[model samples]
Target: MSELIHESVLDIFCKYATLRREEMTLETSLLAAGMDSLDAVEILFALEERFDITIPNPASVTEATVGDVVNLVSKLVAEKEASPSA
Candidate 1:
């Protein structure tokens, strides 16, 4: 699942970002790299379709990094999996 999330992130990033995969850093600014608001929304939408989870804050989209996003996704998926379905 984490691999899938990471791939999905890179896929979306390739669609709009000029930065190479190697250029991405934990502090690399997605905005500075040209991830506009609409692009971010598109990324969120793609993530939703690719993964079966929902991120509450499209705005608070973490600035950690691609790796950070992967970690965040992993954490969220695990949390959701751990919770009992009411």
Candidate 2:
């Protein structure tokens, strides 16, 4: 599940980043590694739009690893599943 989320994020970034998937470590800091803030925001917005969920904050995701993003998304998905809207 985490891998799927990681792939989704990387796929978006790959379109905007010069870096390839192999070049990114799971723990690599995309922010520190030269990912433009605007692109990051775009990716964040894309994730929420694609996933049909709200992401708390982009800043909170700054320190995230690929796995962390996956975990957060997975947790949110699980929560949504646990409490569906009527």
Candidate 3:
């Protein structure tokens, strides 16, 4: 599951930020990868769509690293999966 989430998040970074896969690591900061505020928002939108979840506060995601986003999305995915009403 983490692998899938990682792959998807990497793809989003690649598409929106124009970052190369070789330039990323778990601890790599998105901002350092040339992502600005707008890029973060765009990636958040992509993530929400990809994961089928809603992010109420996109601003908070701007400072996250690749692993952070992966972990966050993974958590959200887990919660949604565990919840019958989600």
Candidate that scores best on TM-score:
3
Candidate 3 structure lDDT: 0.86
lDDT of each: 0.70, 0.71, 0.86
The digit string of per-residue lDDT tens for model 2 on 1-86 reads 66677788778767766667788777766565457667678877888886777888656555566666677777887787788581
- Candidate 1 displacement at residue 37 in angstroms: 0.8
Write the number of the candidate with greater TM-score, choosing between 1 and 2.
Answer: 2
- The C-alpha RMSD of each candidate to the native structure, in angstroms, is 2.7, 2.1, 1.5
Sorting all predicted structures by lDDT, with the top scorer first, yields 3, 2, 1
TM-score of candidate 2 on Cα atoms, chains taken together:
0.78
Q: For residues 1-86, could you state the per-residue lDDT of candidate 3 as single tens digits?
A: 99999999999999766568988898988887778888888888999999998766755565789999999899999999999896
TM-scores for the candidates:
0.73, 0.78, 0.90
Q: What total of clashing residue pairs does each candidate reach? A: 0, 0, 0
Q: Compared to the true structure, candidate 3 yields what TM-score?
A: 0.90
lDDT of 1 by residue, 12-37 (tens): 77787778776766466667566776
Report the C-alpha displacement of residue 12, candidate 1, in angstroms. Answer: 2.0
The lDDT leader among the candidates is: 3
Give me the runs in candidate 2 sitting further than 4 Å from their true place: none
RMSD of 1: 2.7
Q: List the residue pairs that clash in candidate 2.
A: none
Question: By TM-score, highest first, what's the ranking?
Answer: 3, 2, 1
